[model samples]
Structure formats: C-alpha cells, structure tokens
Target: MMGHGPVGVEALPRRVSVPAAPGSCADSLLERDRFEWRLGDPGDPATLIEQFLSTHDLPVTDLARPGDPRRHGDGPCGAALFVSAAAGAVLVDAPPGAPSPAAGVPDVAVIVYGHGPRHHPSAPPGPDGWWRGPWQPSWTAQQHAAAVDAARTAIARGDIYQVNVVGHAAAPYRGDPLPVLARLGGLPGARYGGTLAGAGWAIGCASPETLVELVDGRLVTRPIKGTRPATPAGRAELLASTKERAEHIMIVDLERNDLARVARTGSVRVDDLYAVRRWCDLWQAESTVSASPADGLGLADLLRAVCPGGSVTGAPKLSALRHIAALEPVGRGAAMGALGWVGPGRLDLGLTIRTAAADGDRLHVWAGGGITWGSDPAAEVAEARAKAAPLRTLLR
Candidate 1:
C-alpha cells in the first residue's frame, strides 16, 4: 500500500510552461502509438507515465479548464489517460517511438499518443446508425434501493461515515459511439468533459467535479456531493436539507486529507464550501480544496495518494471501498475514476462521474451519490435515474 507522507513547502518545476490559450488556430497532434497494460503488469504504470513526460518535449496548451475549447490549436503534446475504477489505465496520444512503459497482461490498460500534427478529431463519417438502447441496467431499482438501505445500516452500525452507491446501465450499439460520446464534452458545466477511445473501448465524460489539478506550483481539487434537480424548488430544497450539507462536508474533509498527503504542511485549505452549481439539468453542491505542492511531487506518488477520489469512494475511504466491492453489481469501469491531461509539470483530472464507457458490444453508464444514515432508499433510486437521464438523452 502507498503511504500518505508529508506535504511541505516545495518549489515549482523550472521547465514547466503555461498551456496555450483555451482556443487558438493551430493544428493538434494526431494519434501515433498505442500501448496497453493490465493490473499485474511488470512496470509501475504511474512511474512510466512520469518518465514519458520527462523525456518528451510536449507542447503545453489546450483545454486547460473543464469543457472543450471552441477550436483546435497548438495544444501540448500530451497523452489521454483513462483509468478504470479497478483494473488499470490506458494512455492515448503517446508517440510511437516513446519509451515502452510496460509489458505483459496486454489488454486491460492502454496508452495511445500522437506524433506530428493531424486534423482535429472530428466525428468521422461512419455507418448511418450508431446505437440502440432502452438501456438495460445491471441493478434493478429495487436492488439499488436495497443497496442504499444497506449503506444506511452500515452507517447506523458505526461501520462507515459515508459511502457512495453506484448503479450501472448499459445499452447495445451497432456502429461507432465516438461521435455521440464526443458531444458529451460540450455538456453544460462540464469542468472535465471530453472523449477518449482506444482499440475496443471509449469514454465520454461530462463530469463537473475536479479530482486534482496542478499548475504554476498550486495543486487543487473540487469534489461534488449533494444533488437536486435544476429548478427553483430543487435549489431551495437542496440548500435547506441538513442531510445534504452533512454529506457534502464529509467528502470535502476527505478531499482536504487526500491533498494534504502531497501538499505543504500548512498549505492545504478549503477555498470554497458547498457552492451550488449546475450540470445539465441538475443542481449539485461542490467545494474547492487546494494546497502548495511539496517539492519533487512525482506523478506516481501523487496518484497513489489520491487515485479513486474520496467523493466517489466515501469518507473513511478504505472501509467504504470494502462496502463498495461487496455491494456494487458490477465494476465501475471508467466511471468514478480520473480522466484528463498530464504534461511535464501540469496535471488536471476530473472525477469521472457523469461518465460513460463503450465496449464494442455495449455502451455503459454509471451514476449515484453519497449515502448517509439519513438517506431514503426510494429517493436514492430516483436520484440515480435523474443523474443518468442527461447522458441517456444525449446518447439516444
């Protein structure tokens, strides 16, 4: 297990540069090489990523914040990392000649990078029909409600503070799902929205929460917890709900702890607390936590300290993980993990909530929220559907 160490004063990387403006008229690097690895692969995946960035002179520019830029530009030559909640990760946009990160257990984790400038990744012309669905869920509404009840019981037993309960739904598809999935990046309030594809899988994300971001010596994370519909009544109800506020604070505290592991001793602090924000048609509560990173904060160490974000895993994260493993019907796949850019001294990964994954056979989506003793099983079920509604509508 990776240990959480000191977060003390440190200097920013000397070689780092601010990413290019959000939108500029320059060609972007196209895909060049592809690499995949699994959980038991020989090399440490995170370390390999650190090495790749170190040896390459990647450009530093492009969609720095959440959501896509209006146009393409001479963005940084970086790779896209799609880490599964379990299993491993895939790195896309890596160059063919880049150092081989790892070998063995070929398919589970993958990385594909870009070389010279290629045309922007517009939705290409493909088969006319792309998908089919009345989307089947892995867990029925009753089952999901039962899981919520179980979590509440665990809370009652003093076994955990809070645990996020997720439900999975999937729909069959016939052609490429990339174009439609790519559209997810443009969803309203998408702080970390975009699409990434590899050999047999792809991920479309419209996540509004920031998992972690490092730029110009400062490191930050924004975790979202409570949720309600985007309506006048909904906003009022969400703010009035003591239960929602309590759950939101627990995750905020968790995030502060996560960053403190790699932040300067007194640097970790909450910038904003429980600010209501909109994502699609939902109103959610979010908090911002940031810190001055410790010297020599490598990607491997940083990720180990905070990989599966606390908002998704729960407070008392380890205990929550055990509950999640026993309760969830299926693996989270790419949802609830981290997705975003990584460059020499920069990183921005969003908590992959409101995210979907597409295998050749099916496109999968996962949605849920934090569960506390005060949670209502029936409301939980409805909330999960409400969270998934936008993604489903877009895919349809």
Candidate 2:
C-alpha cells in the first residue's frame, strides 16, 4: 500500500506534476498502487489526515491533534512528503497543481519538514553576521516583567509547575537555506528537515530526547525537562538545582501515566531517571520511560494520549496548556511541536524545541524554560535566554 526510496536532488527525474491543490487531493490519487505522499492538501486537512492514518494503519495517537492551527494548515508555500528507505529521500511537493516529479524515482528529494529551515530564505552570520545590533526581546521589558509575574502567580496557584515562557527578537538574513539544508540533510542519527503543519520548513538538531521510538514492540519516550548551562560553574549549579530535579521528576511521572493508557498492565515504567546529557553547548537532565502497548495499540493512539509533550507544557498538561494559551502572546508554532517519522510498523518522533522556522524573508526562533514554584522571575528569564543562545548562533 505504501513504499519509500532514496532520491537525491541531482538524480531526480522531471515528471509531470500532480494537479491537486495545497490541501485537497483526490482520493483516487491517494489510492494509487504506487507510492504517494503529500504535505498539506487544499481541502480539509483533517479528512486527509484521517485517510492517511487509516490507510497506513497509523494509530490515532500518532496523528497530530486537531485545532492547533499551527500544526495543520496550508503551509506557507505548498505541500509535499519525502520518503527515504534504501534509495534516500523521496519528495512529493504538490504546491497547488504544480507538476509532480516522476513517480518511483529514488535517492533523495527536497522536503523541508520543520519550521527552522523554511522560515528564513538565507542564513544570517553566526556571531559576526550583520551585527544586527545587540539582541534584545522584541517586546518591551515591561511586557516580559508582566509575563514573569503571571508565571509566578500560576505557579503559586498550582496551575503549572514550570512554564517555559519565551520572547522573540528579529534576525534579518539574505542568504539561501540550501547550503545549510545540504549540510544537515541526512546526517547520521539526525532526522534533518521537513515542513510542519503550523510552521514551515524546519531542521531538527535534536539529540538525547527520544519523543517516541519503537524497537521490537517496545515504545520508548525520553523527555528532557531540566537544564543547566554547559560551563563548569553552570553545570555544578545546575546539578545542584533542586527545582530542576523536581520538575524533571514530575514530567517523568506524567509520561509514565500517559504510556499506561495504551500499555499493557504492569508494562509501563521509567527506564532511566534524572540522567544528565552533555550536548554541544548545554547540559540537560533527562529521563526515559518505556512501555509495551496492548495488542491493538498503534502509533496514533500513543501520540494523541501523550502529545503537546508534558516536558514542554508542564504537569497537569491540559491546564498548563490553557494557561499558556492565555499568557503567551504569540502562537508557539512549531517551537514545542514534535517531529520525526512514521512508517510501516515503526515510528520515531521528537519534541520540536530548540528549533527555528523560516518563511521567505522572515526568521522566527523561540526559547523557554519551566517555571516551578521555586522559580525566580529574573532567573527564569535568564534560563530562557541561555536556552535560546545556541539556536541564535546557528541562525546568525
């Protein structure tokens, strides 16, 4: 019913394009015997999603939740799907009646899956770019102060533990993203780029956090919730932060509970707890939870039960999300979304944090951290800044 092949950029064949709109594709095309994939159709995305889920035997949990306008919509340009197995990555971009590439051609094709890549057309300087002046919150300091105050109040009321509040500052660029995409494309152990439902093209530089990975029927989810900067002193202080430990534990418990909904009795448990991970620029506190789903549990069901990841949303996820909706000025887009791959009898997904999005000339990046009861407004803001620093460097 479905298949994949590797199709590189240079080797792609010029084939007649499909005539479907951005969000609407004929059921007949989808039912074709050959492999068919798409980004967003011009019609109802939900219908298309439902059809894909059913056709692929994708679980309801794996499906992105509805109503998050950012996750499901007509993407900035067009819609396409890239598949890779033995050949490379096969891309099918159907930007409203645009000709589809030759079918069955293989190697790799251009399909930006996350928002980080599509948000900006060109790359900005890293530390020495246009020196777009010193970076500061786009919003006034007063607005940030208010958000901190709101977060403190929410923490006091037990409505949330740590709310990762974020701010944005504009970064202008005039370079093509192709070079960066090429560097990142198909990097081993790294699931590179793709377009998102709400966000445009993005790059996933995620390491250590396994949103969802299946191995021999075992489903694993590792969520990193606590952080300390990577410097020696920062690492020492971070390891000593009681608040960070508490936050990590809470999310782990929540994840365990989420897995239980679909897992067999006594099959859900924490495989690792409070493990420290040292990435290139920072240190993170993480925990791993594993579960074996019941006979009928599939990818979609597992995702729906646990999505809007607990680490990003905080404990008592729905309430925290509601509070977040009220407090956050702008939509998160793909900042806190999940990315990865889904295929026959297997899936791998990750939370889309520490990510950036580009669309044409505009570039958007976000950073936030948890706000527990012990959180200090000033300290929380500093943490968010630190988290956003590396991504800022890459964007520059």
Candidate 3:
C-alpha cells in the first residue's frame, strides 16, 4: 500500500536541513547519521500534545503511555517526540542517551538525531551485538498455556470474547544498541520503524500496525491480529482459519468504534478487512479503520479513545485489560505502545510490537497472540514462541 508523499514509515528525506521554522514533519534527526536524546517531563503529555496540534499549529510525536499505567516513572517516554517549532524544539533537557559501545538492545524512550559523531549508519545488526548472558522467560510454555486456559474458561462463561496473552524474556547485556536498531529498522515492510534511547535505556521497533494516523484532515488506523509463519502452507492456513478470521473481525469492529469516538459523525468506515500483509517472516491479517475528527476533538481526546491498540489488548478492551493485568507477569513497557511521526495536519503512530528494550545489562523481548474459543492452548503457546523466534535469533 502507498501514501501521500513520504509519510509514516517513509520518514524524512535524507540531507534535508532542519526547517528554519522546522515545520516539515519529515525534516528531523531521524534521517540523519546521528542525533541526541534524553529524559525530562514535557509537562502533562496530553496537554503538551494538544498545544502542538491546536495552540501552536505545530505537530508533536510521542510514544503513548502503556496499558499498565503504573510504570510511569521508568523515564518520560519522549522516544519519538519531535516538535515543529524551536521553543518546543529542545523537547528533552537531560544529557543525551547516545548508544553505548558494547552493542546491546535499546530500552527507554529517547529521541533520534543530534550531538553525536556522524557516519553512514549500518543497514543491519553489525556483527558485534547479541545477548551474551543467560535468558529467562517470564512465563515458560507450561505457564503460558495455563494462562491461555484461564482465558478460554472465561470465554466459556461469557465473561469475555477474545483476549491477548503475552510473555517476556530477559538477558544480561551492555554497550550500544544502535546497531541492533539499525538491523530491526530495516526489516521488510516495517511501516513504523525507528530507535530512541535514554541514560540506560533504548527502544528498537519494526512494527506493522498503525494505531492511529491523521493526515490531510483524515484519521486512519491499521489493526493487525492474525499471524502465520511465512510459508506457502502457512499462508493458506491463515486465510482459511475460522478462528483467526473471527478474532480479526471482532477487533476490526472494535477499532471502528474507537475511531468513531473522535471521528466526525457519519464519517467512519472500514477501508480494508482481513487484508493480508507480510511483516518480516510472518503473514499477518490486517484491517484499516478511518474517520475524520468530530467537532472540537483534539490529541488528548483521540488518545483516550484508542491507546494500547485493540489487536494487542483484545475486544471489550476494559475486560481484556483486566485479564492481561492479572495474567501477564510484567507491564508492556515501551513495547506495544506507539511510535512514528507527527506533523502539520498530519499524525502517524504504530504499535510497538516486534520491539525490544535494553536496560543496562538486561535485554527484554515480549510476544503473544489473541485467544478465542477455538484457540488451542498448545497452539497459542507455540504462536508466542514463534513470534519471538526472530528477535531471539538476532540477539543470540
């Protein structure tokens, strides 16, 4: 699928100077050889974003607060925050979170561009970086299967329709993570890809889902659910699977409702449903939901309507969140939140799946799948493992 000029994953055109007024969305640190990032609160995130869109007539980009709101102090998630004007230009005040030399993963949210030696960035994970310590799974296969069973039990009782179950693994590491980010950001069909860092943390993402996008006065979102390994047989199976299709439709409907919350009346619709798209080695089922803003809607309002993304959280969002909180061992952190760019009359952000975080000596990676009535416990466990395989291979 194509878009208006170079937007979303296309990012900025290289060598473009930072605008004198710096209003162009794509003209920023991301397209450069190097840039700086750090942590500092931008007042209330919601309010700051609103001003960028309303008062200043500028754009503000950022990672949304994760589903588990309790992890707020981990460091301000200004990972992708870029403002159009100079006053807001210096988004973070702390020291820059440049990549360390050890070659680890990226964890905390840091902006890209500024105050670093310039060089042509490597196109992939330069041979040096990989997890060198023991890795521990937050939930082993048996444990994850138990969680899936619990979700299925709830479904039988009509307590929920579908839910996403997730697990994480951590390993010790050190040094810079930019090389890993470079490799991940180059993944095939990665629409929302980039890297950001902080004092001891950095986040690298190669996501395919657009949680929300507003451009040319229109709002858009691409929700992805079904997944299958990239193979002739696997692809065919994904297209014919009844359970995957049903779960996908339910989430698509949920996304339409979410977009409608902030959309102009009578302006919401599903532009694509059950669309098959390739993300790295997997073939995913995706759908697009779009609408125009309702009178008096703003960034804060749009975020409240949809933040964690339906495909990751599940349908009947609140219920699924409760289950996820009780079932998963740790919060989602910077992964599965949101990332991308923001510009004048344009806003684009994607779910941070296929994401990894590096904090000091620890590297974290997470993966999971949607569970429905037809979902098999064994299959669900396998799915999560399958999703994490690529990252594990790279880090190993």
Candidate 4:
C-alpha cells in the first residue's frame, strides 16, 4: 500500500463519515481510488484463470495451520469471476492483451482490501449518494409458486430430495453501477462481499456464504442453507424448525461428498455445522467443510467439484441442477454463482446469492430458496423476497 497508490481509480478526498451505505459493499473494503483489474482473453474462462495464476505467481502462504493469516481481503488485483447457476463462469477481471501489472503480495503476507487500497487497509468508505431506480419482477408470486410446486412434485416423485429454485428481477439504472454496489454492499454484515467491473459488464456482490477458500493448502467451503429473519424469535424458530434443519443437513452432506471428491483421503471434515450466524437481517445456518487437497488436486478441480454451491443447487447435486434448469423461468445471471478474488496461492470466493450483474442500464438481481417436500410455496416465495429485500430497497 505504501508504494501502491491508487492505480485504477482517481484519488478521492480524505474520508468523511458515510451516512448511508455505498453501492458496492466491496467499496467498504477498498479505496475507490486505488486498485487494479485484468480482463480475460478469448481462452476458456477456467484456463484463463489458471494461466493468470501460473504467470503471476502472487505470494501465497504455506500449508495453512489452524490460525494462519488470510490474504488480500477484497483487493482489486485478483480476479472476480461470475459463474452461471446453470454451469459456466465469466472472469470479469484481467483480460489478456491488456496492460499486465506485476502481481502484488505474492508472499504469505495478509492482504485486506475493504477500507482502503488493495495494499492499504483503512476505514471502509461510506456513502456519497445515489437515486434508487425502477425495478420489475421477472416472475409473479403465482409463477414462482408454480416453480416451487414443480420442484415439490419432483421431490415427491423420488426424482430429487431438495432443489433450490431461484427467480430473477432487474432494475433499470441511468448511471454507473459501482455506486449502486457501494450503497448495497455498504449496508452492513456483508461477508465474501466485493465488486468487479468487466468490459461492458460489472457485478456487485454482497454474498455472505463462501463457496470456497484456499489458504495454506487447506481447501474449505461453507455451505449456507436455512435462513430466517434476524430476530430473537426468528433465530429460535430457525434453530427449532425441523424442516430448515433437515434442508440444511442435506446440503451439508452433499458438501461433504463434494469435498471428499477432491480432498486428501480422510482429510475432509465438517469444521462447523448447524451454526447460526447473522447476515444483514437473516439468521443463516452455515456449515464449514474442509480438507487437504488430494495429491495434485488444484483450484480448477475444486471449482468443478463444488460449484453453484450445493446449498444453492440442492441435494443429489446433478439431479437438482437439472431440475433447477428445467424449472427456472430465466437464467440466473450473476446470482447463485460465486464471486471474489483469486491471487497467489490463495482464493476466497463467495456464493453469489445476494448479487447482481449490471450491464448498461439493467441490474439483474436474483433470489431463491431450497424447496423440500415440506416446503410451502407461498412461504418459499416470501423467503426469496426477504433474501432479496436489501437489494430491492437499494434500488427503490
């Protein structure tokens, strides 16, 4: 941060207290003036990522011990990729044929990027201001209920145990999306949150769940399933609800299997399960699964193993994904995927649930809930709205 002054953006005046949150929560972690990004080439997205890592060789830590430090928390130099819920991902950072900068922080040094420059960690920026824009729901409540019912039928027919059904809603904007992300992400309680601006497109993510994080050779993923409004009664209800617990455990088991596929034999374990955590106004049930990589396993393999996270896709992963494809009305653009940084030997990406992709005047936001046999279509729809409320308000 010392020599690394603001690189990508213009320097701003000294920070004044922000009354409202910024558009992108990642802004809270990084200095709006300082940071760098790369765009991808015509090569396959995953291949491009691998190429960048191999060429840059950013400083990475040793095999992670229990309490080792984490690197580049929301820095701009790393890549911010958005994979589709249906299957592929787009690298919104670092394209080939662009000015390639030196990879910073290749050592085991801890990098934190929310409050200031990627190199400098300072107080997160606060709100300047922006106008809420017009929003339109892609699907009516009835249509969403129909989708939930369809998933329920699939469950009853023994085709799947649980399926996450998501819906999309987009708002038209007139200005830059960076500010929108700043305000939305700045609201508070955003984990694995950040923003990435690519050519002709940008994504603002305030995702709370970590799809995967690599540190010191330890492969980890925290699958978040159940959610309830943040309240004393809501928290108790979430913990007591047999349905939520069952749905959460299903994803946990699925995640364990997903990890086992790439983890060193007997290295995978559930570090945390049925853990109640707060994110914005929701009480979420999150479980952490970690393992050492099997000999020769790399990031690409891990991404494939647990993508569009099981919590979002549901149990019997492949089957759930197929069902999701058949059921969803519109494609999940930036939501339901993963977003965050990939640098050096470390990668920390979040499940892109509470995220939006901004292309020109359109901001596509998506929300969904897992549909189980006991799921109530109306309630599921409400839960989806609740999950999406923060973004909707920001747009309003």
Candidate 5:
C-alpha cells in the first residue's frame, strides 16, 4: 500500500493496486500511467466523457462481436469514471504516465490494481486508520420513515408508482480512510468493489448491482431491488413477499425501457428475473436485462440513456427524481452514481450503492430502498440501517 499525503496536497503517482482477497471481484488492473480530469458539465457528462476518452485515445467499445468473453477484470483499464448523483463526473485515464490534474478537486479518484511481485511504502501511523467515533445521521429514523410515508402518499395520489427514499450519515475521522475503504471494497459478494481516491475526496465501493456493462456488442444491466437479512428465513421471506416481487418487477420494467432506447430493434430481453443474491449478510432480489446496441452508438449516448439507474430512482424515472430532490435532506453525492472501468469496445460500471466517500474532514455514507404503496414506514427505516451497517462497521 502507498502512503497518503495530506488531503488535497500531493498528486497520486501513476499505478495503483488493491491486493485482492481469495475469490474476490476486486481484482488488480495494473495501469501503466494515468491522467485525471474533472468535468463540470453535470447535465451532459456523457458528451464530455466521450470527448475526453477520444482525445486521450481511450474509448467506447464498438469492435466487440458476439461471443466475446467478458473482460471486466482481466485487462488493463483504459480509464475509470466516477459519476455523482449531482450530475457531474470525474474521468481518469489508465494508460501510462504521471497523473496530470485538470483544475479543481476531483469527486472520486481512480486506482487500478494488478498482480505480480511488488512493494510500496506504508502510510504514516497516525493517519493510517479510522477512529470509532459516534456517526450521525442526516435524518432520524422517524424522519426517514416520514419520507417513506410521503412516497406512499405520492403513490396513493397517482403521482408516482415508487420512489427510492435515501438517507445520509456522516462522521469525522482523523486518519486516511484508505484502509477502511479497502476493507469495505473487499467484503464478500462485492461484485463491483474497489477504492478510488482523488485529492480531497475518495470513494470506497462495494456494490453488488450492475448499473451497466457492454461486451460483445451487447449492453447489459442488472437492477437490484427488495432486500432482507441474509439468513435462511430472510431468503425465504424475500422470495415469498409479493410486495418485494412487485418492487423488483417495476425496476426491471424501467430498466428494460432505459436499454430499449439505445438497443438494436427487437433485441432487448430479460435474461433473468428476481434472482435472490447475497451481499454480505443481506439477501436482495436482482434481475438481468440486456440488449444489442444500435449501430454507431457511443459511450455518451449509452450513459444518457440508462444513467442514474432506475433501481436507485423509481418507476417513471423523471418524476421520481423530482420527488427525490424535494425530499432528501442532502445531496446523494457519490452514492447512487456509476463507478468502474471503461475500455474500448468494453465497459463495466456498477451502481454506487453500498458506497461511501471521505472528504478530507468527514466520511459520508448513504443508504435507502425503493418505496412502494405497500411499504411499511418502520420497516423501511430499519432496511436503510441494515444496508448501511456493513459499511459503518468496516469504517470502525
């Protein structure tokens, strides 16, 4: 592991690697060199991202053909992007060379890890680990439950079918958050887990849901909804609940529509439906949807189509977004966005759920679930805590 300097001071040297645990998805992408740029265009990050990648000779995958093996974790990452829920994105090139910063602080940093023998200087002792401080929630359980009821009311009024009510929690930390981040990213069932850091802010991701991925000319997304504890009874309850199934189906339909916009005619299909998956100690329902890309589709076009994923939003994505803006206490920040590697003719990005950010002074975390008319307000509050507990536990 490399030592971290004072936040926002020194630039990260070229390559970065996270030592992968046994059977871990957080593999190493030994980058040759890197360059960092911050795109302020929140409304149109796709265009900026596409342009940046093109200018830097990194790009969208168009050459992938049918039957090409999935290369998500095996190859050198061309670039990695961190898109924030606030409508902005950060791009990092993954070729070779020292990091060349653009201008302001980056929202999230990019680090690619690879295998083989290597050594790095250890971080200083004082700023090395996190303190077990009292974490604070942006919304109390009552407040979060009230938001859930509000969503249910909206559903009753026919304003929206379902809305994801998010809650935020934060705590001050005295040390570098890298170790906590690494441990969070290495947790079991983290299909999309890793640490990406910038000057002032950093994200430790342990997302199990796939926001979007493209390989062999096919675009794929796995929207996860409906959660329960990860136990025999929890799995049974999750699979049996009609309400959970309904929530899962709604997001599946929404995802299908999102992909249909850029899919080849009549090529979209649901590969799986409501499969229960384990993420640490939780059981969540996930469904797979895929489509062949339309001819000449680009990365910018794809992101514009399915970004701010429906599972995190709600049915009728735009309206749900409007409600979310009005109800949430704080901005979603790095959570509920997209994070992962982007390579030419191949891309793999995960939905930033179960993700946390550290901004020099404080560490931030967000968690929530889809709210439907049948949702129980109290249960919803507990669900959010259940989702956040793992990350919080790892932080200590």
Candidate 6:
C-alpha cells in the first residue's frame, strides 16, 4: 500500500480550479503523480460531509449521508461523508498502444487517519515510467467451473443454498483517482471523499445497495442483493423474478447475523425488505436492517467483522471465503473491500462495486454475481456482462 504524511486537520479554503470540461481534473491531479492525505478533524461522518459540501459549493440536493443502522445493526461504525458532481469530459477507453498508469504512480495508496499506523515510504518508480502489473481476474473460467461444481456438490448434499465466489485483479496505481472516477460518471448518485479504515480518501462512482446510516443514536444497514437490467420494459419482470427475491433474502439474513454479533440483544431487525431501486443501467432489490449496539462496540470492531461484504460473499461466510481463495487467480486488492471514512466516534464505508482502477494505460473494471444451485454457468457469465455494461459504455 502507498503511504504519505498525515494530513493536517485545519480547514483550507476550497479553491480548486474547476475543470473546463468534465473529467479534466485527472490531468492536473496526475501531473505531480504523488499521493497525499487531506485530513479532517474528528466528527460525525454526516457533519463532516455537510461541511465539505458547503465549503466546496456543491449542490445540497446531490448530498446524502448513509442512514442510521443502529436500529438494525446493519452499517459500519464511523460515519462517511459523500459528494456528487457531473463527470466532465474524460476518457474511459484505452487508446491502442498507449502505456498504462502503473508506470507512473505507486501500486496501492493506503490513506491513514483516526487510529491506524503511519504511512510507509513510497516505492521506487517502475522502469516503464508507469507501473506495469498484470490484469488477471481473481477467478479463471476453469476455477469458476470447479467452484461451481463444488457448490453444486455441496447443494446436492444440502449443506447450503448459495455461495458467492470473488476474484481479484491488481495493477499499479496511476496518479489521481479523479480520472478513474470521472469515467465512472456522477449521474447515478455517485459519492466522493470521506474516511475509510482510518484513512482520508475519496471513492468515486460507488453505487451502494447497503447504506449504513446513523439516526437518533441508532444505526441502519441496507443490503442490496438482487439485480436485473434497468430497461423500462424489463423492470416489472426483473422485480417479479423469484430467483432475485430468494437471493436478496439470503444476504439480508446474513447481514442481520453479522450485525447481531455487535448489536444489543433483540436489537437487530429488518426495517424494509426486497425493495427495488433503479440506477442508470440496472435495477436492484434491497432490504434495510437496523440495530442498536450494546455499548462498547466501536467503529473499528464493526469494520473488522465486515471487511469484505456478505452480498459479495455467500452464506456461511468463512466457507465461501475459502472457496473464493481457492478459485480466484489474483488478489481482489480493494475491489470488494469497503472504502470510506472512519473517525473517532463515526464511520462510513461503501462496498467497492461499480468502480474502475487504472493500472497504467489499461483501465480495469471487475464485476461478478452470486451463484446458487440453480445458477447456469452461461447465465452467470451473462450476469457479469450485464453488470459491467454501464462501466463498459462509459469507458467507450
């Protein structure tokens, strides 16, 4: 992970030059090619986010904070701050023969704040001037096939209903996150900036199905599990599908159990179940679970319990993780990991889905879906394609 000196908490004037066109900020931020931590004082995620919004002159209408999950025990410990803006002109596609970004920047940049360790020294530059790393998926077709066979075998034995196998791809870090994020677009309620894992950084274009919000000394977690095409005509059929509903319920149950471990007894409960939400190119089925902690459960503990999200992992999480480890080829890196902010008494995190990273000239985007006993390999591939479609178009 890349490291930098601690960011001072003193408020600075919000005087960033506006990009002439959308996504143009990449060129400026990348010119230096060095990562820096822009720190903030300890405060509630919501309040800090609001301050950012006001300071940046961002639109209030586009601002949103994750709701309270205390009543449902469904969210991370610290609060998160988020902001959205138009994605100006940016290139999402790779130009043929162009070099990747890895040659220019570090492989990974880990931000530190709150209660994490200090930054590590930056690594030597790559010979190519950009880091050149492989872009292999965590899971290969053969490995996926084997995992599916194992899952099927398990199902036949009636051990579990479904399992989510995750894969990873690691590349060198390019300069600024803005360029990658700009290609992601902000139309579909994209969030930017906040603390994560005790670090201050910005996450771009993350469409979270599960929102951990704080309300009235309580916490709420909303888990999104099922997804379908976002076309108008396909909407009804998508929501009516029983398969989607079943998958949604399984993850909901899993999330509740996770929260129950840290929440007060009888404090865990589902607030909303199987609700449909429409984004730019997809539709999702989501459920809201709430819980109140039994005093002493802090943000760090909550994060440790849920690092990789359950929706991305199948039921009986540990077994699913083992299966994923055996099946995938590369490390997921930050793909499925939570990214956001964590301060003294507040924490906010988002599952790193619908995100793209630059390795050098190559831009990497990862997508996958849950597989159940009824899953067809061909259909599973198709699901991944459907999920990647939005990102693919933007890149094009």
Point out where model 1 deviates above 4 Å. Answer: 1-26, 55-76, 87-127
lDDT per residue as tens, model 6, 283-355: 7777888888656654434543444567876776666665555545444433554444432233445565665
**Model 2, runs deviating above 4 Å:** 1-50, 53-138, 181-204
Leading candidate by lDDT: 5
Off by over 4 Å in 4: 1-44, 58-78, 88-132
Worst 10 residues of 1 by lDDT: 1-10
The worst-scoring run of ten residues by lDDT in candidate 4 lies at 100-109
Q: Poorest 10 consecutive residues of model 5 by lDDT?
A: 93-102
Give lDDT tens digits, candidate 4, residues 1-396: 211132233434322212112323333443232122323224544444444444433333222321222343443333334454433322212111111111121101112233454233365443344344666787899999999999999999999999899887776665555655645666566775555553355556777888888766778898889989999999999999999999999988998898898777899888888999988888999889888877666555666677668888777877777777677766676577666655444467778788766664576788899999999999999999998989777755
Question: Taking the tens digit of each residue's C-alpha lDDT, what string does model 3 give over 1-396?
Answer: 011122122443323221111223223334222222222433544454555333322333322211221222322212244221111112211112122221322222213232222335323434463435777887778999999999999889887899888778887665455455445655777776665544455666777788887655668889999999889888999999898999999999999988888777899988888988998789999998888777667666676677667787776877777677677766565565666654433457777788776665677787899999889999898888888777766665
TM-score per candidate: 0.82, 0.66, 0.75, 0.76, 0.83, 0.62
Model 6 regions lying over 4 Å from their true place:
1-150, 167-177, 185-205, 344-346, 359-362
On residues 1-396, what C-alpha lDDT tens digit does candidate 5 reach at each position?
123453321343322422222223223334444444443435345666676666655545342332223344444435667666545212211111111111123533333333333335444234445564678888889999999999999999999999998888888777667667767766888988876766566678899989988855679999999999999999999999999999899999999999998888899999999999999999999999999988777777787777778998888887788788777867777788788876545478888899887775678888999999999999999999999999998888
Number of clashes recorded per candidate: 20, 58, 16, 30, 10, 53
Candidate 3 differs from the real structure by a C-alpha RMSD in angstroms, to one decimal, of 10.7
Q: How are the candidates ranked when ordered by TM-score, highest leading?
A: 5, 1, 4, 3, 2, 6
Q: Arrange candidates by lDDT, descending.
A: 5, 1, 4, 3, 2, 6
What overall lDDT, based on C-alpha atoms, would model 2 receive against the true structure? 0.50
| lDDT of candidates 1 onward, in order | 0.67, 0.50, 0.61, 0.64, 0.71, 0.47
lDDT of 2 by residue, 1-396 (tens): 011122223322212112111222211111111223333324333233335545533343432221122232322222233221111101111111111121122112223211112121333223222222244455565676677789779888877776656565545444433233233222222332333211123232333356666656677888888777678886787678887888888989888987888778999878888877775567788888998877666443554565667777666766666666566665554355555544333356656566554434445566777777777777677777777666566555
RMSD of each candidate relative to the true structure = 10.2, 12.6, 10.7, 8.5, 6.6, 12.7
Candidate with more favorable, higher lDDT: 2 or 5 = 5
Worst 10 residues of 3 by lDDT: 84-93
